[model samples]
Target: MKLSSADIARYVASDISDGSYVNLGIGMPMLVSDYIPEEREFILHTENGMLGMGPAAAEGEEDWDIVNAGKQAVSILQGGSYFHHADSFAMIRGGHIDISILGAYEVAANGDIANWLIPGPRPPAVGGAMDLVAGAKQVWVMLSSHVSKNGEPKVVESCALPLTGVGCVNRIYSDLAIIDITADGPLVTAMMEGLKREDLQAKTGAILNFVPKCEILKSFKNEA
Candidate 1:
């Protein structure tokens, strides 16, 4: 079964460290904030200048002053601090962030990520993605295993879209499996239940390596 947005977030949350600082990118990646284990005490950072932020605000509990880089309503933890964009970028660029979770369009076998734009004449939006990818200690992506409309592969041998950052992605959290990009190519670290090695390979644009110690993502299904 395909993992829901919440399921993916929960899985990503599990991999992150308890006291680590993370920058959650917009779109699907932002929802990860909602699933972080309460005891983990991970600090959430937003490019808009909020550190120690909380999940999306409850209905009627929204706060205009508190928001993420996406401009969505957010909440602040007790010790959360709001600062200027300059300082925020410093935190992002100076390598203070431990892990960054982002949504992606395509990821190359060499760990190249293309998430900012597709080839077309449209208004471009390249926010702090480039900085996060380049500056973070580890970069993790959250996306569907295949293109939503055509069922084409998103984890490709090479990215066809505009590059966000090359050789930056460490791991990918997709609906069908958890893949790790290595010097050898895309490694199958974990896959969803009932999906054989061949099944994941057929849908992939590049090769999929099976590490004997690879994990089967059966526990994530238990979250349902």
Candidate 2:
């Protein structure tokens, strides 16, 4: 079965180390904050002038003024502080963040990302993606295993869309697999249950190697 957005989010939360500062990009990346353990000490950052962000606000609990970079309602943890947008971006561009989880359109085998645009007449917003990729200690992409519309691969030998950053991605969390873009090439590090190497290969435009013992990923992130 395909992983739900929440399930994919739980998987992303597993890669986050305790006490790390993380920026959750818009879309599914934002859901990860909800799955992270309260004891884990993760400080969620948003490009929109909020730091130490909490989970999405409960219905009727939303402070319309309090939101993430995507303008989605959110809560703030104890000791969480608000700052100027310039200062917030300073924290990002200054490289103070530990990891940035972003949703991707296409990621190349060499760790290049193409997420901001698809090279058409669609009105585009660049947002903070480029800065996040450049300054974060590690950039992890979160997306589906394949492009759903055409059944084309999202993980490709080369990105077909415009580039976000050159060789910036470290890891990818997809619906079917977890991959690491190591120096040698893109490595399929983990996959969902009942999925085979052949199935993953058939969907990917990039090459895949079965590590003989590729670890299957699970989500106990919500557990204490």
Candidate 3:
């Protein structure tokens, strides 16, 4: 359906439940906050040790001390709280977070995730990804379908990077499509406008099984 990155972001935002505690991972996952309805209350947690994080502050409002997992400066809401790093991780490892939005390099059909590490001289950091993938009740991965800037497939049969976790992802929001990792396989729940199922599959390295008569959201249509 030729969805853009913004479409993927909107898809993830729409799935967030009111008042749910969510942890946004680095990279594309961080963009979900901008799409979330301001009126809807969602508590954001950062592993670097802040909770109840607000959206990116305006110019001159940056707080050097407060930041998200990405280490980017952030703002705190009125009811926000701060804690030690150990305690913050305890909250994550103890399963206090309702949902986690993460960026992925590859997602297996069994829901395995591998976004933290890539081979070579300068590998990507693992950071708090392992904890988030393991602890969150639902792990939503946001990524593009292709692997390279040249447009190779990233939805692989198996991840080439060091895995963050095995069978941790519950849902995936990608540029070209939205999918859910079910017991059966990767189900193509939605495709972007003008994109056909075959077209999406052709670009995907992994096998896909679409649910019969799944409702596909082509555009922003209010919170669902």
Local distance difference test, per candidate? Answer: 0.87, 0.85, 0.82
Model 2: per-residue Cα lDDT over 1-224, one tens digit each: 56667778888887788999999888778788777866688899988887789877899888899988888788898989999978988888898999999999899999999999976788987989999999899999989545556798999999889999999999988888888999888888788778878988888889876566887765444557
Per-residue lDDT of 153-224 in model 1, one digit per residue for the tens?
Answer: 899999999899999999998888888889999998888878888988988898988889777765455543
- Stretches of candidate 1 exceeding 4 Å from the true structure: 219-224
Backbone N/Cα/C clashes per model:
0, 0, 2
Where is model 2 poorest over a 10-residue stretch in terms of lDDT? 215-224
Off by over 4 Å in 3: 219-224
Between candidates 1 and 2, the one scoring higher on lDDT is 1
Q: List the residue pairs that clash in candidate 1.
A: none
Give the TM-score of each candidate. Answer: 0.93, 0.91, 0.91
How far in Å is the alpha carbon of 178 misplaced in model 2? 0.5
The best-first sequence of candidates by lDDT reads 1, 2, 3
Give the number of the best model, judged by TM-score: 1
TM-score of 3: 0.91
